[model samples]
Target: MFKDITPNQLFDLKQSKMTIVDVRSPKEFQDATIPGAINMPLFSDEERSVIGTIYKLEGQEAAKDLGLKICAKKLPEYIEAFKQLPQPLTVFCWRGGMRSKTVATVLDLMNIHVTKLSGGIKAYRNWIKEQLDTLPLPELFVLNGCTGSGKTHMLHTLEKEGYPVIELERMASHRGSIFGHIGRKPLNQRTFDLVLGEALLTLKNAPYIVIEGESSRIGKIKIPDRFYQHKEASHQYVIALPIAQRIELILAEYQPEIHHDQFIEAFSIIKRRIHTPVAHRIDEALKNHNYREAIRDLLDYYYDPRYRHTLNYNEEQMTTFKVTSIEDALAKLRAILPALHVF
Candidate 1:
């Protein structure tokens, strides 16, 4: 027999051995879903639209009859797919509606017991909002720096070394810059919230979490207000690197040669903001494939000037680190973890 569980209960089972199956239409699943949940849509986009239109125009009975007809032909395929998934499973739809109920009922009849998400994805979304609003986050150790200072790389390295770290940029799929979206597809707000909520819960018991300093927005996604407030008030470690090293790091990470067209497009967006002479210089450098010169000009004229005014720390709350390389930075940071008593 299948069992029904609330959204809170489902979250409590996140560390357990189970799979979450989203049975909404493909488009619905694509829009947002629980982290790590697999898409096992009950209907294709068109089929769902037809069913919805029938329910609105012809009534529920007609829509049910059509849905039954569609399901009958697909029963064998659905059974095979469900059987292949790792179980015991938890299934959900938009509102714990017909789709999930149908899946649970059918699987049960086949002697495959499963748990149903009581109010489905909609309820889970509400739960996520509540968690973000009220959850007590661990103290944050914010890493602050200008572009190409390797803050993102440091966050991942700290995480690998057993330090709790929240990678906001990775979660948002953006680097929090004008050129942030060049090679990466940004996550919509809903997907960003989903991943962030999961990360917060996963590290709920940690002593503290290390994070890169960022503006409230990463690409188009906005950080939740409560979390951003904590980040603003946290102690910051400012990373200082030489201009030559910063340019080298940027070139290695972005590979402007491979994304030449994208770089041109990004430059177009900021053309009016930059001085005409400097902007023309960058344009000429790009056309001549002198990426290093273009990058230096942008950093010196555009990024560094903008970054200086955004620094939000006092002497008492901030520490500065001057490192020759990423490895040197990592070593210095790791050494401080012991002093901070994080271990």
Candidate 2:
């Protein structure tokens, strides 16, 4: 028998010093998991599948015998890993079931001082969903700007200066654009929520949060309606950069992630809007590695035209700053902080 703690208890304990171990299969761990928990699977993906088949075809007793045999062989490795882990570790599995119990039992016997999560990761996920829906969010301030104005860069700079900022793109692993997935592996919606919730939780007590203005969807993930509603109503500041400078900034930021195929494909998407002839030229330029020209044409003909309406829509309420470079952007941002009172 092993001790088990409720999800609430686990959530509270997370604030303190402790290591959380996830004992689910690797695939499950990768799709979504507790933010800080490490994956220490009791069964590899293939082994879990094999055990599942045995349980379905044979029976529980047969599966148990098989599992025990497999565990016996790997026990030495597991023990060695546990020996190096910080003490007072917490362990969990998909449903606070046998997998986690089996591992926790071993650690306990080794005098590692372990606690098992009651109802497991599933319960923790439920708690996360509830928190996302009901947790009181700090005042959210939107940082609005034309494409490639370096808003994301400014957000990171502000965070480094002790300002409360949340980089949504980083959390979602997508850049919040048509090209968002170019070089990034987008997280599934469940994983997005897990990380977003974790980010929000950390900022719960901040005076306010600075975030980029983005549509509801970022890659495959959808911003929760509640959070999106807050974003819609929050005060916003716009950063302005000259078209040439914007193009240069965009190219520099995406340079490492640029692939000819992907760049051509992205331009193809705007073919119907900007027309095939123009899109064709851009595509050809990208294929030839003329990135600066391609980016310039896309910004001028595609992104700029599409985003122009924002400048006029709420002209009176929005604060706009014209910045020519990163240093200029920071200075302008600092000028607005007094108004935001975040200092």
Highest-scoring model, TM-score: 1
- Candidate 1 clash total? 0
Model 2 C-alpha lDDT per residue in residues 1-343, reported as the tens digit of each score: 4579988788778879689999999999997888789998999999999999999999999999999999999999988998888877899998999999999999888878899999998888888889899999877768888789998888888888888888889988888777777777888888788778877876787778889988788877899999988887777787788878788778777762446677667666766778677788877788778888777888878877777754453656677777778789788777766444354
Per-model TM-score, in order, reads: 0.97, 0.92
How many clashes in candidate 2? 0
Q: Number of backbone collisions per candidate, in order? A: 0, 0
Q: For residues 50-100, could you state the per-residue lDDT of candidate 1 as single tens digits?
A: 999999999999999999999999999999999998888899999998999
On lDDT, the leading prediction is 1
Q: Scored by CA lDDT, what does every candidate get?
A: 0.90, 0.82
In terms of TM-score, how similar is model 1 to the real structure? 0.97
The residue pairs that clash in candidate 2, if any, are none
